[model samples]
Target: MAKDLTVKDVLYALEYMRDALVRTPISDGRARWNMRLTGASVKESVANQVRASGSVSGIEDTGTQIIVWRVAA
Candidate 1:
């Protein structure tokens, strides 16, 4: 079954992504990953947190999904 993620779940997932990007690298540095959204509305709030967390460089919202990246980091 599929489940919608809550704000808290998103935050934790972001933390995990941050840790992965910071610690593990695709090759030289963290590039990006396509993160699943709990809902469309979650994008508005989480986008800022992702940027502010500095876990990723930024995100690309395509209405359908958000891609978390750390290319600059």
Candidate 2:
């Protein structure tokens, strides 16, 4: 079953994930933000978030119907 997640929920998840990486010394990082929405909505929301916060560099649509958000260094 797919999970219904709102824009706020997605953003919160991303923030939490980024906070969790604060201790690690990594050059580049990536995090996957999965949403139950359709492909178009997923793409739109991802783009909005990327524009709102420059932290997100890009997004990838996994063949398994999952959206992956690539965090900028």
Candidate 3:
């Protein structure tokens, strides 16, 4: 049976994805990956702890389904 996702779970997932993005070094490969992962606005925005959560949430609404990409941090 399929399992249901909770809002808290989604929030946690977003946090992980955001952290991964933050940890990524600024390089050509990272740039390409960033483009694929995040949007124009996110790339433009500063990658700080405070801003990362907002940025990740903007990309996807974790209210419905949990973003699987973001595993447990």
2 versus 3: better lDDT goes to: 2
lDDT values for all models:
0.42, 0.38, 0.33
User: lDDT by residue for model 3 over 1-73, one digit each (tens)?
Assistant: 5343333433443555442222333445342112224422232223333234543422333222122232332
What shift in Å separates residue 44 of candidate 3 from its native position after superposition?
Answer: 29
Off by over 4 Å in 2: 1-3, 19-55, 59-72
Q: Candidate 2 lDDT, tens digit per residue, 1-73?
A: 6555556556554555441111111246533333333221333454355436644434333322222234523
The TM-scores, one per candidate, come to 0.33, 0.31, 0.26
Against the true structure, whose lDDT is highest? 1
Per-residue lDDT tens digits for candidate 1, residues 1-73, read: 5554444555565555432211112465533333443322343444445556754554334422343545523
What lDDT is reached at residue 8 by model 1? 58
Measured by TM-score, how close is model 2 to the native structure? 0.31
At residue 21, what lDDT does model 2 achieve? 14
Which is superior by TM-score, 1 or 3?
A: 1
